[model samples]
Target: MRLTRTILAFALLAAVAPIALAQSQVEITSDVFVMNEAARQAEFEGNVMVVHPNVTVWAPKVVATYGEGGTTDIRTFEASGGNVRLKTADQDATGERAVFTPGDQLLRLTGNVKVTNASGTVDASELVVNLETNVSTFTSTGGGRVTGIFTSQ
Candidate 1:
């Protein structure tokens, strides 16, 4: 079932409004959309898909929490499901859950996370990326080990 895009568009606007990029239009769709203005939160479920100029995400559910300062400021953007997949110009990743904290410029993916790029592929129980420092740390759980394969340019 298709729902109206107007509400979703407005909700997403608040999420991307802070971006100064030239083309920052974001298109999001889902079978369900729940918005709480007072709480400054929006939830999308069932075939949730978000498309931005720099990245695209597909998941069964997504929750966006905005900051108190204003709707334009997003605090946390989270995607969770059996299989959540995200793609960008350079990489593709899949995990059970992905959470991004805009305030700290940090992204965390957990639960059998696997990331692949032109350079290589990495598998771990969790992956944390600090966008501010441009660092990615991957680790495993339950005595498991993180593994990856790389290719020389």
Candidate 2:
């Protein structure tokens, strides 16, 4: 009888563990919003704000997609219309438009992108960022400028 009780307890704990681990919470705010229930996606318009974990992003409009099959693909995160603001522990970026591929941890910003960190600030017409590697490439189109300001702190 004691052995059977112990086995049942372990089985119950095992079943609940996965449930707790797989759960996620997302919060979004905007002037107007629409959600697709079947796809588990959302679109926000007019001063959109998205917060997940330690990251916060703000833009004029944003579309968010989630992955299927218990993965963190994120599918696509696109921000347009106005400047995008992304704040994380390591860095911060601002641009006119931004697209992020969460699975790859890649962020592409265009139309006057500017990135600032403890090191300095880089401004360009286009910026591609690899979040995982902390590397960024800046480029210009039609006579753009990149200005860096380094401070010793």
Each model's C-alpha lDDT?
0.81, 0.68
Question: Which 10-residue window in model 1 sums to the lowest lDDT?
Answer: 14-23
Model 1 spans > 4 angstroms off: 1-11, 17-23
Best by TM-score: 1
lDDT of 1 by residue, 1-153 (tens): 135445544856546522212346777789998777668778889999988887888999988888776556678888998789989899999999999887787889999999999999999999998877989999999999999999999
Off by over 4 Å in 2: 1-24, 36-41, 65-73
Question: What does candidate 1 score on TM?
Answer: 0.86
TM-score for all predictions? 0.86, 0.69
Cα lDDT of candidate 1 equals: 0.81
Measured over all alpha carbons after superposition, the RMSD of each candidate to the real structure, in angstroms, is 4.0, 10.1
How well is each residue in 1-153 modelled by candidate 2, as lDDT tens digits?
667544533332222212112324546678986655466455679988766655678889987665563223346778888678878787898888888775677778898777888988888889887877979788988865677788888
> Positional deviation of 11 in candidate 1, in angstroms?
5.0
